[model samples]
Target chain A: MRLRLRPRDDSYYEMFTDSANNLVIAARLLVELMSDGADREAITEKMRACEHAGDDATHAIMRRLNKGSAPPINREDIYQLASNLDDVMDSMEAAVDLIGLYGLERLPKGIIDQIEVLERAAELTAEAMPRLRHLDDLTRYWIEINQLENQADRIYRKLLARLFSGEYDALTVLKLKDVIEELENAADAFEHVANTVETIVVKNG
Target chain B: MRLRLRPRDDSYYEMFTDSANNLVIAARLLVELMSDGADREAITEKMRACEHAGDDATHAIMRRLNKGSAPPINREDIYQLASNLDDVMDSMEAAVDLIGLYGLERLPKGIIDQIEVLERAAELTAEAMPRLRHLDDLTRYWIEINQLENQADRIYRKLLARLFSGEYDALTVLKLKDVIEELENAADAFEHVANTVETIVVKNG
Candidate 1:
């Protein structure tokens, strides 16, 4: 008797594909919000909007989990991955909200640079995501995503060190620390994506 | 054709399970450390040990992702969950580390109350975790775990409101906030567990 593998559902696969797309788009929006440098209120609104969209997508995935059969992989795993992606967006939005809410407009360049690193990480995550469905040739994307995540970690450490060592006023130090943490969180979310992608590739391949 | 759904051999699932257990144990230890009112250095060392254990578990899961088989979820979703779980631990550990590292000898009653909530949430999480392994009758565990998480959130809200109500000195306020956030973080970690368990139940049940 031959054991037949469960056929991968195209629609469920598509949901993940869309989730990856949303994350990439959210990352791009974050970068835009930074570069646009609009008024505080405007930036906050934009960030909030991005967060809302990301949340919708994440919730959609969760709702999907409840509404459909499990994907070829573990349902809990997918839910976790989706929630983490949403967290990245949530943290980004919160940073912007806190800045606007607390009137912290002047941020250090180093923190902004870390945000850039996060953007890059998000892009790498986006690139790695599609490969998960294929599970056949997963080496390149998985390795690159991990490399990007590690780079993000190194940047976080460097940023933290600079944050502590550099001379700044107490209030400035505090605000910058929060900003740096948010950026680090964004990177962490991306690293989660990389981690998940690698896991899928390894298990399925 | 009979479709056989074989369990994936990836080690991330096991690593995550171990991490879940470690987190619960850590919370219990933290409660002991706080209640014992040990010397600053002693409490710090114990907290560090818990943090180290959590870090090791995270590293193991990530390492498995990078080198072993792919995880059993959507790449994007897995990435998000793993990263968020790590963040929860990082934040919680930082809160405790700061306490000992900064020579905080006494925890306020309010903070202690919050820590109790966190400990309770962790306990609920540990209880819910084993259900994930067994696909049957898991929804009940998820529901109870989520209720515990919500209870923790309420404790956080009430505590934070009290903190900001002009009842404490500035330094005291800052430290209290840090501790509160950390306790809230442990609660957040359990929320993640609930989300994961719910998804698993959806899939298997």
Candidate 2:
């Protein structure tokens, strides 16, 4: 091997990948929440466990950053990246929590559209985290997430209109809206994660 | 002034103060929304105008940061401060917009409690911005805002319990909850702003 100058701290990359992968699992849990006759209580419990896993991943990254073990990127970027990933999981968990709390049964068909967008975004994010080492390919990730966010917004508005269409009673609307809104927030949180990555690339790459 | 070597970009302080001051105005407008026979439409229109003004203030700061002006603090802190302040305004504006969209006739009594907390937080924030120059006195500001946020949370959950207490019909509950949730978000955003300020003081001061 050629003579190396500095030992690169690649653990940060691995930690971030673990965090993003946790989001993917959480997104799939959300998908299961949309399934017909699915055990939502069990799924919500699983989602809670998934969120805990995400918190552990986030805490691991933070502990490493605090150690100041020759950070691969700026401390703040790593903090923001960890926090944003954590935020996505939190939003997803909140959605499940509300679904159970409000006794939300028979979710609208439009909800599938919202959940699908989240699943796609989560998958894309998982794919993009490994590529963080090479920033050039991230432009595509950023563009696609932006587009996915837009799509999620549109689906959200449509759901809003449908809820207000007088088909469902107000209380039912409130419960469903709470669930859908959390998913939308999850999507937005994904975009925030992408933005942090872009910031990292622009500043360091 | 006698031995000044580095010219300080105190304009950042001024811009931040302006933004916080704008939130004060917006919060007061929210108070007016709670008034008996209040011209809510006119108030919402004014709130929209206030949000636009906030946007302008945020853009001015961003433009200044972009021009390579000597930021007294780290550039990221400035960016976060501006964005968090902007988020406060956006959430306030959204509350008003949804109130109008849902044609909320009369709000619950607990809403006044929420508005009062926001107004107080906004005032405290406006007072704190100038003291940013001397990061030492900021402890009171941070402590008070955190207390206020905790207060806001208690008020929110109480209101949620009240909403679900079989008092109002489901439709009204939906409308009021949307408005209340946005206000809660504004309070959380204010805390985010304080966190950024603390970060600045920790790193730079």
Candidate 3:
């Protein structure tokens, strides 16, 4: 009888990539929501679905981790990466949901800048997730995510200054700041995901 | 010749307890800051120092983790617990700093409620940290912290409803919400720390 070891399952990487893709989808939807005359309800509903899908992907990864002998990378790294990606999705969903809950009809100028940073960060994250398998070419991914987070931080501070400058009514300033802060958090979450991946690479290398 | 294995260093548990004690001190200071006729500058300055001490404790734990062969628990669990404890301190410090930066003379009513829950949670956390060595009597600690977080979430939602009810002007609502959200995040961080402990207990049991 021929004996064969089970092939090392690599599906965790695929699931991580899927979650990253969901973040990209959510980020794009957010950008579209800020556009003129966009269908807010439909776009946000789709974003919600994307966030749900990300959660499902994370669950799948966890289930696999529980059953599998060991993952290619450290198990905790996988868990942290999954959780941080889920956080990015959660922050994006919260920002969109608050927009709807607060009945915000107009987009603030600073929001567009914030969304642009989120979109780029999400794109970079999606691009980086697959590299976990080989741990190659990841330095630029994390570095650029860090730079994007710094940019988002600057935009966030400037947005707050503008909000409090009395250019807009108090209510308007409050609502816009809520949304902007979530976007900033989403950017931070992206940086956190990148940091986790960097840690995994360093440990595994 | 006699062979002896290096004794397992258990100082990480002590450092964790120290960090949790720092959280309790910060939380108490936060409660004091919300009191009438409180010295905002001095109280927040002291809170800043508490946060710095928590950072130092966390750094010590990390330094030990890096050099030590192994911990009683999983290395990643140790890292997660320490990091989450540090995050609780960070959120509290951020809330206090923002309160100072906004230069608000008076706090909203809900802040006191939030601070009380934080104080209780911090106390519970301090009580729980030492149990990390034995993994005994941890279930009640985490369960109570989870309940406290739920209580905090209820208060937070009610607080938001009040903020938007037009009792206060838009700017005050803006400032208060920023502080309130950080408090909520602190509560969430506490829950996260508890959850990490629960995971460790389950794994080690």
First chain of candidate 3, TM-score: 0.93
Model 3, A1-205: lDDT tens per residue? Answer: 1111121246777788888988888898988998888999998788877866876787677667656556788776787898899889989998988787677787668889999999999999989888888998999999999999999999999989988887778687777777888999999999999999989988987
TM-scores for every candidate against the unseen true structure: 0.60, 0.68, 0.67
**Judged by DockQ cut-offs, is candidate 1 incorrect, acceptable, medium or high?**
incorrect
True contacts kept of each: 0.33, 0.13, 0.13
lDDT tens digits, residues A82-189, model 2? 999999999999999998898877888998899899999999998998888666588789889979997997688678767877889866776788888899999999
Q: After the best TM-score superposition of candidate 2, give how far the Cα of residue B86 lies from its true spot, in angstroms.
A: 3.0
Which sections of candidate 3 miss by over 4 Å? A1-10, A39-49, A59-68, A143-166, B1-71, B74-131, B134-158, B198-205
Q: What is the Cα-based TM-score of model 3?
A: 0.67
Model 1, A1-205: lDDT tens per residue? 1111221245545655565655556565556656645555655665556665665666666666776755777665677677767777767765665565445556655655666776666666656556666664556655666676677678777877776775765445555666667777777777676677666656666
How good is the docking of model 2, as DockQ?
0.15
- How far residue A130's Cα lies from its native spot in candidate 3, in Å, is 2.4
Candidate 2 reference-contact recovery: 0.13
lDDT string for model 1 (B1-205, tens) is 1111212345455655566666666666567766664555665566667667777766666666676466665444445445655665676678878786556666666766667766776666656544544555656666676677657765665665565455665577678778778777777776775675565456545
What is the CA-based DockQ of model 1?
0.21
- Interface root mean square deviation per prediction: 3.8, 3.5, 3.6
Off by over 4 Å in 2: A1-71, A79-83, A86-106, A116-131, A134-161, A164-166, A169-175, A198-205, B1-10, B35-70, B134-166, B202-205
